[model samples]
Target: MAKKVKVTDACQGCTLCTMTCPSVFAMNADNLAEAIVAEIPEGEEAAVEEAAANCPAGAIEIE
Candidate 1:
């Protein structure tokens, strides 16, 4: 099955997710990182997972 990603309220406005998975994440107007794609793109799951793993605020959520 495919994966989905989201940025939680705990985001610390850090760009790590954007830098780690630019294809799937981006910075919104609030400066917090957000999942840019509605769904995780093919072969990008690893990066998404890594972003979540590396997020200092532990704000990234994957389902």
Candidate 2:
């Protein structure tokens, strides 16, 4: 199943998520990361998980 990914308010605008998964994540005007797509793409699951794991603020959520 496709996972649902989100960047919560806990994000610190670190840009790590965006760099880790540029295809699915982007930095908003506030510089916080946001999921460009609601559903994680087929091969992008690992990338998303990596971003979440590497997030210093632990703001990325994958469901």
Candidate 3:
């Protein structure tokens, strides 16, 4: 199973995660990266990790 991810305080409202993994991540009304679990599939773990790795602020956390 894929783990849940949280956006941390380090978030700078950067859209990198959203752009990198649109299925799991999106930009909120405030332009912050929000995880949309309904859209993310269980097998996309690598993609999610890639998005997290690409985040400049290190905001995405998997648990």
What's the lDDT for candidate 2? 0.92
Clashing pairs in 1: none
For every model shown, what is its TM-score relative to the native structure? 0.94, 0.96, 0.84
Off by over 4 Å in 3: 38-40
Q: How accurate is candidate 1 locally (lDDT)?
A: 0.92
Error of 3 at 15 (Å): 0.6
Deviation in Å, model 1, residue 18 alpha carbon: 0.3
In the order shown, the candidates' Cα RMSDs to the true structure are: 0.7, 0.6, 2.0
**Clash count, one per candidate:** 0, 0, 0
User: Which ranges of candidate 2 are over 4 A from the true structure?
Assistant: none
In candidate 3, position 56 carries an lDDT of: 95
Q: Please list the C-alpha lDDT of all candidates, in the order they appear.
A: 0.92, 0.92, 0.82
Ranking by TM-score: 2, 1, 3
State in Å the error of residue 14, model 2: 0.6
Q: Give the winner by lDDT: 1 or 3.
A: 1
Per-residue C-alpha lDDT of model 3 across residues 1-63, encoded as one tens digit per residue: 557887777889978888888888888888787788833477788889999898999998888
Against the true structure, candidate 3 reaches a TM-score of 0.84
